[model samples]
Target: MPRIKPLPDELDPLAAQLVVRLRELKTHGELTMRRLAAGTGYSARSWERYLGGTSLPPRAAVEALARLTGTDPVRLLAMHEIAAASWDIRRAESPGEHEPEEQRRSEDEKGERREQEREQGQPPRRLPHIALTAGVLALTVAFMAALLLVLRLDENVAPAAVATPAGTAATTPPHSYLCRIARTDGRWSAGINNGRDTEISYGDTGTDVAEAQCLLRRAGISPGGIDGMFGPLTLRAVKTFQDRAGLVVDGMLGPRSWKALRG
Candidate 1:
């Protein structure tokens, strides 16, 4: 059994859990990295990165591991969903840090053209002033539309915490949610939170997270502290409950996971 490296301290919590679970599965099957690479059709270096928490493993790679270990792929796939969302969030938050190769190539080409223009004593092409004004107007309209959509969603979903006005330096604190767990018809319900199918995951902060945390405690899995924040501990508790209840362990509180948690 190859020793796995410690996960990065700054790794997304959900992604960290996925890597830990993958490591556990690897150890349970007594499979070496090289063996996993060969069986999964991925390079050993790739497996190292995946298991080491430096990279998110592809769904195909995870499925291949399940196949080789004779384990059900459904649970692993559920975990993948959470990890994938975390990976996407990281990428979105640091777009410039991980620019795509094609985008880099395009930028380089533009830079080269600008250098050539300078060498030839020609001014670089610029957009027309009218075009720029039109673009600004379009952007303003789009922003307004997006703001309206967000307001509509907030009205429909749940009450939102007060937001800081645009161009303000002050930040508003996140809302604190309390769990009001109650037993009704042999099932559990959070009286304050009423969404039966709302999907909550790591980084979510609301009554829904509090509701899941309350149910997780009811299931005898502590979600760390029920602070209404769906952090790493909540994710682990969710996966544990999912595994015990024979539900997919994707770590997200989806419809099926919600059903299991409620039941």
Candidate 2:
């Protein structure tokens, strides 16, 4: 078994927790990445990324681990959901990124509202009445500041396992953890790397062809062996895999076929 890499410290606290728990369960089950791949249909390399926190594990991976380790799927799945949600929110909140168009529009609307008030002479009236309105404005600002502070504190902390309603927390549902994978940018980390789209056919031999062969073999259509050669056996294997993958059954490996093979 390969040595496990340390979980990334920079991961969102919730995601870090999920990865740590997965590592504990994987160790408790005494299953190597190879055995896990054999049992779960995910590649050992995929498990490496997932457990190392370099990539988020798919829902199927989570469920498989829960089943193997006898952990409460409901709770683990909730953690997975919260972790995934944090990943998305972090990406959205990346510093110095372009402001969302909707938010930009919202700012413009606020400016327009302020301008309208000014044109209506409200500013003048408010200026003359500042002594009366000052206390109200100060109180409003203080309240908003306190509210923002609390919200920011919440953002910095990891969410609890249960939801609080009526001041009581209950376990979250497993389905609540269900979510879509991050954008197309996350595909490579998800084991769906489609970097090279060269047309690979018979006699085309290299790392690219070998990867295709590996994916084919994993799908139970052996390409003779992973010798990095696109020989006759490899061609037949590609066609067979394409057929099963609902592809065009072309002997050549292209983008669509590569996507199917990786997935």
Candidate 3:
């Protein structure tokens, strides 16, 4: 049982997803880092870095891992391509990279070269060993287009809350509209909240808090008793749910928490 570090929120989601898949493959194959290295040409140190998400493995390394573990290569390769692009974007955006004038010039030069090559109508010459990268990029783009297709999470989303006069009772909200997917199971149907938004928190006793607890139950998390009180039990459950959902894990049922629980 190797201890795996919890992935922080700062990690790029695309790269994070690939790291998750690689870990699964490694676990299923019952491989140590040394074993993985033996099965692939890459070093065990490289596997450590890749699995830790400090580095993205090369395409061939990804393919080798998939073969050794009997995993499908297409999806992993597509994800790897996306992870690489996204990782590059993150590095380019980092503040430290901007502080170095030399680094900035290098990036600008690379960008200019690419633009010039495109303008010249010169097809990218491919080395046979890495020729598949182009195809992988195309597949990754198509895959992303499908996955990132945007539809409203809930057609009946509540309108933004209006300012209320002092001492007026706030309106109870419908489920959070921030559910991860556009589609949810029928039990978690979406409607509208015509009322003011109410945040459900621990130590709070109200019908809205109770409803939030029930929604948590629907999401397969137990928040102690549904007594409408935000107690420690409810707090723990909220944090657990947030962590699983890659949320802030702050134990507060904000809009995103509300949406995921509602889902």
Order of all candidates by TM-score, from best down to worst? 3, 1, 2
Best by TM-score: 3
Better of 1 and 3 by TM-score: 3
lDDT by residue for model 2 (77-135), tens: 66676677666555544532235433444547757977998888783322335564565
Q: Tens digits of per-residue lDDT for model 1 on 161-200?
A: 4343486333222344566778888878876577465898
lDDT of each: 0.70, 0.63, 0.64
* Candidate 2's TM-score: 0.37
- TM-score of every candidate: 0.38, 0.37, 0.39
Off by over 4 Å in 2: 95-263
**lDDT tens digits, residue span 110-195, model 3:** 67987998999998654344555565566657646743532212323434443444874443332222212223453352122222
Q: How much lDDT does candidate 1 score?
A: 0.70
**Candidate 2: residue pairs that collide:** none
TM-score of 3: 0.39
- On the 0 to 100 scale, the lDDT of residue 86 in model 3 is 68
Worst 10 residues of 2 by lDDT: 174-183
Runs in model 3 lying further than 4 Å from the true structure: 95-263
